[model samples]
Target: MEKQLSKKIKELVLGFQINELTEALVYERIATFVKDEKDKQTLLRIAADERCHAEVWKSYTKEAVKPKMGQVRKWTLLARIFGYTFALKKMENGEKGATKAYDEISKEIPEAKKISEDEDRHERELLQILDEERLKYVGSMVLGLSDALVEISGTLAGLTFALQNNKLIALSGLITGISATLSMGSSEYLSAKSDGEEKPFKSALYTGIAYVITVTLMILPYLLLPSSMFMVSLSIMLLTVVLIIAGFSYYVAVAKELSFKKRFIEMAGISLSVSAISFIIGILVKQFLGIDI
Candidate 1:
């Protein structure tokens, strides 16, 4: 019984070490790929933090028990096979799985729960790091793209209602697309710079390019159709629906705690609110100013 308990403790220690190593590697990858110099520096800091965490776990394991050479080798092999991506994926699966295994052995063995808690702390720290830097940009880009698609698409639809000709509708859409792109891109750039964060020029440039691309693609269908009001309106609505779904899916994926119904309701509410305001503005312009295309 004592021997069995000892083996279990060794396994848990090895698992914690593997998790820390995987987190370190993730930080390395993020640092390599991130365009913003500040973001890259942040990732490097996170990687150093994770390395310290791994060292602590290793020290504890060394003090806890002496495992056979074969056993140590086997665990190392397992860690390498799982790789950083797979380990992070598992961690994101939830704290429950990691805790379950830790809980089963932590009480029976000394210092096991402490190690487990350390791993949990490391996971939370990694999450906070991601939230602070990468996730914010991801959320901004997604929301920005979604907003541009729905707003500009609705604008085109309303203009089609007034224009009643495909060529005229396409021309109006082109103008709206260009105007929205410039406006959104400028807004994003200035907002990033104003936040007191070091804004890399490349990050801002890429964001501008992406904003233009997403908006242009969203409105292009309306331009390609024949000079029919019905087809143009239909195309815009379809694109809006697709954008809403895409945005909802992204929100749900990132917001794992939220139920599907709740995420859908929240995202749908925001999309509808924006669309409604844009539509009202369009109607008022067409009626009051005689801005018919």
Candidate 2:
């Protein structure tokens, strides 16, 4: 006869059961749209592992449990938006604590140890074959974003004090930003070509897109606000810069398994420092030149 689980152990086992089933559903759903055969196969295999885990837990719980459809939908939507690699990494990171739980539960149920080992294997497999396209051009994206943040943030800061007119600042920023985007794209293209990169044009396109998007976000406040609200617009623009840095940093951190805090602080610090210096220069220039526009 099988050993009966205690009430507390049974409840914990059932929770893991639900989690495993939900993840299985999520993986199966993601596999449908995945184009690569290898990647699709990996996802399906992991989904099978998840199902097996749920079954193992079910034997102990002595009852059936439903998959968390909400969690399934959430992961599915995240994968749609952010790509499967990020969503998978984020999901895996969320489940790290479960391994410890399984370890503790193994004393009551020997099968828990096997389930834990399977979980570790799932991670190894996913990490090995997760080849999302967007991740390939992260360097280009970072180049464009970092350059835009540093250059445009400083330009906007200087113009906000020097011009003192939101409309004028917006126009100036748009012209400068668009010109810089083209130049950066062309430069990246040439650089990639010289470096013998396989897809130079695509690299340049990614760089240009990242640059233009960052420029639009950074200059949006000035365009939307009144001339008298230059200070407010500048403040909002600066905050937007921080937010962009934070968001990009988070995305890269999750997708690449890097340090979020370190990247955020470094990028934010450089962009704000340049902006501060330019702001001071703007004040001094305005005072000396006596040009009030």
Candidate 3:
């Protein structure tokens, strides 16, 4: 005799049913566009598993339900832009929480035990095998980003007060940033070559690209704005620093399953701290030397 499901358990089952079906469709759609044979097959396998899970939930609900179209489209588009690894990991993260929900429902229904296990464990292991180039070179990104934040932020802060002219500051910062980017890239290439990194050239490229992008973003305010409005430009530059730190930290957290709050605060704090110290130094330098730009 089948045990009767309570109202709460029934609702949970129905919701899971809808989500599973939606995700299955999302995976299938992404698989069609993927060029790699291994990747396509993996996506298809996951889609099949999702469909199986949906059927499991349907048995409890005893009702046919449509997938949530909005959710399906969102994941599909995200995968298309961000690549399958990020999108798949992001979707898997959602399933992590869903496993806990499934665990609770499993108390009333034994069949849900397998569903919870698959969601919590097996899916994660499967996703670990997916090759993601961006994640592989994340260390290079960190190196480039950290150096830019510390060096550029400090340079801008000190110059903002010392030069007191946006054009002068922008020119100086751009020159310094460009030189540093080249130097950093060259050093990274030589170091990686010596260390026997599989692709030294590629690593160096990532470092240079990251550094150049950061420099451009940091210098944009000074280029676009008037030289007289130094304070406003300075504030905007500072805000850009914070936003860059926050944004990169978030991307890393999602892709690598790291602590977002800890990473964000640490990077922001270090960058801002250096800027503050340099700002004071600039004021002292200007007053003591009596040099004005």
Estimate the TM-score of every prediction.
0.54, 0.95, 0.89
Runs with alpha carbons beyond 4 Å of true place in candidate 3: 1-8, 33-37, 95-104
Best by lDDT: 2
Please list the C-alpha lDDT of all candidates, in the order they appear: 0.59, 0.91, 0.87
Instruction: Give per-residue CA lDDT, model 3, range 221-275, as digits (tens).
Output: 8889999988788899899999999988988888888999999999999999999
Off by over 4 Å in 2: none
- With candidate 2 superimposed using the best TM-score fit, by how many Å does residue 153's alpha carbon deviate from the native? 0.3
Model 2 per-residue lDDT tens digits across residues 1-293: 87888887887898999988998999999999888788898899889988988898887787988999999999999999988988988998887778677777887988778867867886666666778788999999999999999999999999999999999999999999999999999999999999999999999999999999999999999999889899999999999999999999999999998999999999999999999999999999999999988
TM-score of 3: 0.89
How much is the lDDT of residue 149 in candidate 1?
A: 55
Steric clash pairs (candidate 3): none
Better of 1 and 3 by lDDT: 3
